[model samples]
Target: MAAELRLLLLLVCWTALASSRCEFPAIFNFGDSNSDTGGLSASFGEAVPPNGESFFHGPAGRFCDGRLVIDFIAQHSGLPYLNAYLDSVGSNFSHGANFATAGSTILRQNTTLFQSGFSPFSLDVQSWQFNQFKTRGGVAYGKGGVYRELLPKQQVFSKALYTFDIGQNDLTSGLFRNLSIDEVKAYIPDALAQFSDVVKGIYDQGGRSFWIHNTGPFGCLAYVLERLPVLASQIDQAGCATPFNELAQFFNEKLNQTVVRLRKHFPHAVFTYVDVYSVKYELISQAKKNGFGNPLRACCGHGGKYNYNMNLGCGGKKKVAGRQVLVGSSCADPWRYVNWDGVHYTQAGNKFVFDHIVDGKFSDPPRPLRLACHKHI
Candidate 1:
């Protein structure tokens, strides 16, 4: 009788693992800079100095001091490091691909920096990728290949987890250009709705489970405060603009609601909200409450006071008047800091966020909607 009971327990555990929606064959990512690996470098631009100096010690094409959160999560989930979609050299989508670009938005109007070619992760690009995977035959191998690869080795990502980290750049651009807070607020719900539609598009193309990361605390980011005068007077020390943060919270709340609604629309789909807003809030609050000093300060920055620039990047030298001058500065310790510059996070900072996601702290496990996204294999 004891042996029979033990057999029953094993069967129950196996059943639970099989039922989770995340049990996909592999992961495919979409969204913007927060998850971008090398998308920005694919485009022509003035090279920023302080980008990617921490772990790789050079511009490895990331906007951070080291690996971004997506890289870490992929590693933690026991998958190969996600390759940038444009990385012709080593990206193998036999598992999946990342089409996220730096500074991409769901809506074309939300584009911030690269205004000339301002194409949000428009349906066009997503469709293009889908088509490419179905044809290109090289690194851009077709979806048929992915399907074949997975059928045999489905266990690798039997519960494939997707990660989307975008939207900050969109909001940042409007706020920096002196747009009214109310104007930005008005656009957010529409953005969330558009973003939700994009996710659903992916689902229609064979995606099973998804983890949608809400936007971070844009108000607390140092760049926003420095760029917006009104924010300086209101909540400058916090490094985030108060109105922006509130807008972010508002958007996230609505985003969660949208995710809830999506669950009803697609009952078989497992949608999870990665609450980056709260995770970031905790990091900054802890930094401030402990007087960490330089909470708002970036670990790598050029210039002083109001005019910080990343153009000079860390450890670079510039020549002026026949003499060389250091173009940028790096913090004494990157692990202790959060903001990499006015735009990104340190490796340590991302690790902290990862801890929260895997453990399900400060919120319920499997998210409130509770779809079968991350079941054990």
Candidate 2:
């Protein structure tokens, strides 16, 4: 009877492991505004209303009107929405934490192009924060010495997904500073070096599953189209700036090459290079078929061909023609527009992109969303 009881206990343990829906116990994300849950708001107290009006109904510190792709990813992966690392009160770090910040660059140094100011917490800084979190077991320990076992086992860190969506700011900042595309391309090696160091640092900390997204098509963004010089002939059939799109393609090429090298360096690591550029460009190229009404215009902001006014920006009140007026206002339907407030995507746009990329075809190893948890297991 005792032997039978021991056999039953073994079966129960096997069943629990087999029935587990998600492969990884947690997901630790690193990026810029593209996936910043609340790091920017916690740091600077910005990202107020109209910013998260769609689903959240209030500013959740995400750059979108509603949810980010990362939020959708968390939901799809059977994990809770990742909380910002800086959020101290009532945050459940068991699912994982987001270390992304708005306006974050890959390199620690401030870019001279476009007067892009220094980010207090860049990717390097975020990686450092991750190291600190790993050392402390979780953010709760750092807060008050309350040793909560967020990452209980050292093996849990190896099983967690380490995702990234950065480096756009590095390229955009150079472009904004009036640096030529050639000059911007020259910075790729240095940016990739920094990115490599971050990945290596995480690897050293025992992170093995990586999902790194390449930068999207920046040329198609309303902000870039408004600021950069574009000839009428240079515009594509989809109304995107072709020259800028080419630049983005070039950057992706280089990034893919770097990913190949990283794969060689970390042979045992599951490094999925997410093709964000292709997925986003397809949405713009086929907007009419994809249920989008305005692919090139922004849902908010004022005074430009693309409805993106640099002076007004997004969610800000500005004096236009000597009168104080709201410069940015929500459109009647944000779902119909691809670009939101010039730079970021509308919630609908983000969902569309997420749906396409989550299938694993966009990933290097082709690990589907449902299998992401089991890929390394």
Candidate 3:
């Protein structure tokens, strides 16, 4: 009788584990500018010409020459591109919704966006927005018909893959405020605590699969190089500021630890931590070897050594001889360049990073993106 009971328990355990492997029907993303589709544009204004010229053929609300990494992730999953939750016009939320906005941080800031250039829609606010989307979507879907075709099925929430690509802005928010590097690092724990809160909130709402991206090496970005200039001696072989890259590495270490803790806390949920910093650093450092142009220079800008002007940005106009002239124009071959406009990645750069990570080469637990739903244990 004892042996029979033990066999029954084993069968039940095997059944539970087997049921965990289902196709990911949807993707729900939360992040900053890196993954934003159109959330910022919907609130502010269009990203404007030459922004999406490479692949989109026109302005497509992305701060790039074309699609973002998130777009590629969706394509690989056989899911439609996620529409911005804020963008009401011609948006379809059947497969997923993007709550990311440019200049977003993991934690809310004390200063206003106009003052410091950070978004008010931090991780907490974004999680609250998700809750609202789920609740309101359920109401709209109950009527069926067009609503059913638009919003996701209620069960999709539990089965969806949740992706996060934030926390970079949190570090920048401190730097831009004239805080020392150590000062910025001091608050990272607080920032990550807020991040964990959002994850727990989502888990409570039945989100079981998580894909979190660590912040990239901002030292290689033209904007950071220009804003926080370091001595020539401090510049690494890659022409990147070593201090900043070191700081980024420290941040990534902490982020990895956070993911490990989360996995322990929620054994049932699958957490995938992606090392985006390494992938980005590799591309930027060896850009020319990989058939790319100047890695640090912007494809669209006004002037200066890095082809970037803080005063006027991409799609910016200058009054030349009393006439408005488009100064921040695109480079001849955008695909050959690594940086797009001093801040964000170009479509080519985005695709390169996606290609490397899509196969799970850079992800924790070493599982491919589409198979993120499966728990290794």
Candidate 4:
């Protein structure tokens, strides 16, 4: 009788300890500028002030006025803010690290879609870097061996959350190259295949929990609205470019299908396909209710209908009416606008999306984001 009682106590204690363990002790993120904390800034010294003026008070390498969605996720999970994989100074790997870089694409060859040249850090390249990180016992190879800590301890990597928010550049680059809509659609399969390969690679390396975000409503971006005159008539009553939104919707639909296929392939893996488009579109569709006064305009940039001047770029200086002025002038009230500098979201906008994404319905596996950290526990 005493032996059985002791056994019961032991089992109860073990279960309690397992439940009490910190939820999602670590997180590994991969994507482009949308979630880049500082990789692009560390590499090229871009994203300078007033880029991060709103909240960070200085450019922290985020392509926004403040935090990215990843930052919010980290905060909610009780993990420390992620350090960019390339940042050399003041980096902490106890939680995990971010491998995202501005301009990263799903396909390596997609770089040719741009006239400036190719991006060296494709999703495949990021995957390779991740492999290197594992081989070196958590030490990152490039950017002066920025991360030196023995991270994602062999056991931690299996329980960590792996998040991905890429492929926007792939489609955008095709559009910039003037590819027909059908041609651009044709690229979806290849992009999804590469995405699958990336996830498989991570799975092979012990990662099992995933939080993936689909591309948002790119057509609603101030930059796209300014550049695509043909889409002018497609603007709806709410001021969103309908045709471009349709493109985004199509891409998201295909992406969701791909996620379904991946689920079948990795039956045991937890794949959370976050509906970024729906959340972002909701904000746009009900901007007034969200406290946003100008959902269709960018908070920065100059010399265009949407205040997005491609030639001068955001924060660039140019002669304006005799006096030299910053072409991409920041607005006095960033919170009132949804788009920032034509391409990215304002800090306020990102926060709204983060709130909805964590509400459970947006996540494919239908788990609350806060609970996702404890999923494998």
Q: Scored by Cα lDDT, where does model 1 land?
A: 0.64
**Clash pairs, model 2 backbone:** 23-373, 113-177, 114-177
- Tell me the lDDT of model 4 at 373: 41
Ranking by TM-score: 3, 2, 4, 1
lDDT of 4 at 363: 68
Q: After superposition, how far is residue 64 of candidate 2 from its true place, in Å?
A: 1.1
Model 2 agreement with the true structure over 99-124: per-residue lDDT tens digits: 99888888775453235544567889
Model 3 quality (TM-score)? 0.94
Candidate 3: residue pairs that collide = none
Best by lDDT: 3
Better of 1 and 3 by lDDT: 3
**Ordered list by lDDT, greatest first:** 3, 2, 4, 1
Pairs of residues clashing in candidate 4: none
lDDT assessment of candidate 4: 0.79
The lDDT per prediction is 0.64, 0.81, 0.90, 0.79
- The better-scoring model by lDDT among 1 and 2 is 2
lDDT tens digits by residue: candidate 4, 1-377: 99667555644544554555447878999999899999877877768667988988887888788888999999988888899888867887668889998878888753331453335688998898878767675434322433435355667788888999987777777787788778988988998898999999999998888899999888778767766655446778778777767877788889899988987888778787899888998998899998997787778777666778777666778776998866676899998888888889999999999999875567665556755544322
Give one digit per residue, the lDDT tens place, for model 1 in 190-292.
Answer: 7777777777766665566777788888776666666564524666455556777887887778778887788778777666677878888778867755334
Predicted structure with the largest TM-score when compared to the true one: 3
